[model samples]
Target: MKKLIACVLTLVLAVSAVGAMAEGLTFSWWGGDARHEATQAAVAAFTEATGVTVENTYSAWSGWEDKMSQYFASDSAFDVNQVNWNWLFSFVDGEGKSKMYDLNQVADIIDLTQFADAALAQCTVNGELLAIPVSMTGRIFYWNETTWQKAGLETPKTLAELMAAGQIFAEKLGDEYYPLALGTYDKMILMVHYLECKYGTDWVTDNKLNYTVEQIAEGVQFIQDLEDAHVIPSAETLIGDGADSLDKNPKWMDGVYAGIWEWDSSASKFGAALSDGQNFVVGEYFTDIGEFQGGFTKVSLALCIANSAADKQTAAQLIEFLLNSDEGARLMNSQRGIPLSAKANALCQTEGLLDPMVAEANGKVIAWCKNGLDPQFEAAALKNSDGVYADAFDGLSYGDYDVEEAAEVLVEGINEVLGA
Candidate 1:
């Protein structure tokens, strides 16, 4: 009887040790309700299969950055988290730094080679592969086909054509509608697309504040012509008093604007609006010069590990599962952008999980910074183009800025930001 009791006790202790080894690991991410639901489902499945418990914390985008900052500053590090590709440098830099695990450790598990060149490129800083990008973003021009016809023009194929179309809409539509709806609240996003189209991604990336005065003048001139022709509508009218007016802007939903410069992932949102009484179609991406064939670049949303983790191996497993697994690709679908992994993309395609337009859009995009820019330099140079186009393109209504002056001010602003 005693010998039997001892064996049972040994079994009990072994079970307890196994359970202790499989304790819950926490992962934090910021996403909308739908993303949270899908991602949690994926996590639950992963937990059940691996016999590991996962604790997830999800939040809206506005406060997510602060949440991450606090986590980084805390005693207990966040095990795994979502990070914007642009913001990766901020975390990995500085003294007493957040160290990223080498990708080579899990190369076989994660399949890094499966990702697109553009997506992989963005996630790589220095020589280390610090993160796995969940999806890629591409810039595209979205236009209302019905509105274009009303303005007595076909879809503009190039920048000149777009400007010409805008002039026609201004003359024809007048007060009934604006030629194009520009987001005043999120002016930076629109500015980046336009600046890239106008100057090419290379010029914008490489020049930074050091861009010769001529380049600034050229960008300003492009904006001036568009504004003078009434290509972009009044920012105040569309944006009201805030910095996030794209969804709330009636002109866009009501089918009054000619087009929009937005990300490809945004197509579905606009498409849904179209189903609910809005008439529109996403047009081909147009540049100031022409259709920018080389302008194709992917903006990545990366999954990164915090330097302070109790179990780096656990975090790596989560990342690997998400990037390389079929379930993970479906969970990330529209929320992340487009999956960067070849297997993930293939599985999504096979399952019909990908939106056709998104796939089409991805085929054309390239890396945002093809020349491999320093993140700080990229941020500074990007600020040069950010809202300058808004003022340059819509200065007539503001009456405080114009194309030429806005151009000069933009150069000064960029130069100042870059400490040039």
Candidate 2:
């Protein structure tokens, strides 16, 4: 009887020990190679320090939205998730509740003071701090100087110069080359910039379309003009090339596509894709376009804790380590753009971990942005799930619909999304 009791006690103690050491948490994110590598390193370092086990799920940008949507709907999302800034709006229901753990509730572990007020404000929905902003970003021009010089042209500083360079490229570099490469989403952003430049207004105001169908038609026409001038590749041509994304396209890597309007945070990946010795430079905003700056800046990505997480405290601790610790800052560097945490940003600077072009572009974009970004701007209805932006813009690009039809479709689709 004594031996039996002793054995049972030993087994119970062993189980308790295992439970104490099993601080398992799952983290999910989407990114390219650099971001994945950096994030894995950071997670490993955190695990080593805390004796916490972490399972990491990462992938490229493609299909992430649909995958995450399913996860959120099923309440099976990772304990810690990297979410788009705009997702907060859709993730919350009519009751203004979200499936995101309120970070403010875990403020003790996750150092909210490390972030700026503005950054924190962006993550708050219905008075709940749903997530923490990782970085601020805006789309801007990045040019391949090597390609431009080969075409015997300088980097363009104005819309007129950019248009002229298209003709120059066609003459100097042959029919296959274009001065710019833009995908469907890229076209939407560029069109917004042009419209804001021309009209001095925001894209949406108070959950409504700010521009009329006629004005939007003009924007679509401008995109057609660029395609006609050979300044940018046609949607049909890009689709026929069969590349999954612009970063993976051989044309972009080989300098056949000389310029991209991409997020400042994404500048490094695009630069890395170019051939060795190919120069990548940030181009100036078109000063001649308008009195107001044509671009908008907002949080690039946010770190959120899932409402269904089994261990909220452990998840919060992991977030703190990743966003506040000097070691985590060094490991992460600026792969997810610049860190939003003041302390992390300073640590990165002191450690010289920031990419120069990314840093410079971030500064330039912050200075040049004048408009407030809306969460609905990137709604799945507008951008992904048979999105209006893609349907109208791609139809126009493929010559299935002219400017007028595309404009009518765009306005109608946007209204359906906004319920206006």
Q: In the order shown, what is each candidate's alpha-carbon RMSD?
A: 6.1, 3.4
- Lowest summed lDDT across 10 adjacent residues in model 2 is found at 88-97
- Compared with the true structure, model 2 gives a TM-score of 0.94
What residue pairs are clashing in model 1? 185-243, 296-365, 296-366, 297-365, 297-366, 297-367, 298-366
Model 1 error, position 143 (Å) = 1.8
At residue 63, candidate 1 shows an lDDT of: 55
lDDT (Cα, tens digit) per residue for candidate 1, span 46-114: 887787788898876665665676666664556787776666665654562445555656676667777
lDDT of 2 by residue, 302-365 (tens): 9999998999999999999999998899999899998989999998998889988989999999
Clashes of each: 7, 0
lDDT for each candidate structure = 0.63, 0.91
> Which candidate achieves the best lDDT against the true structure?
2
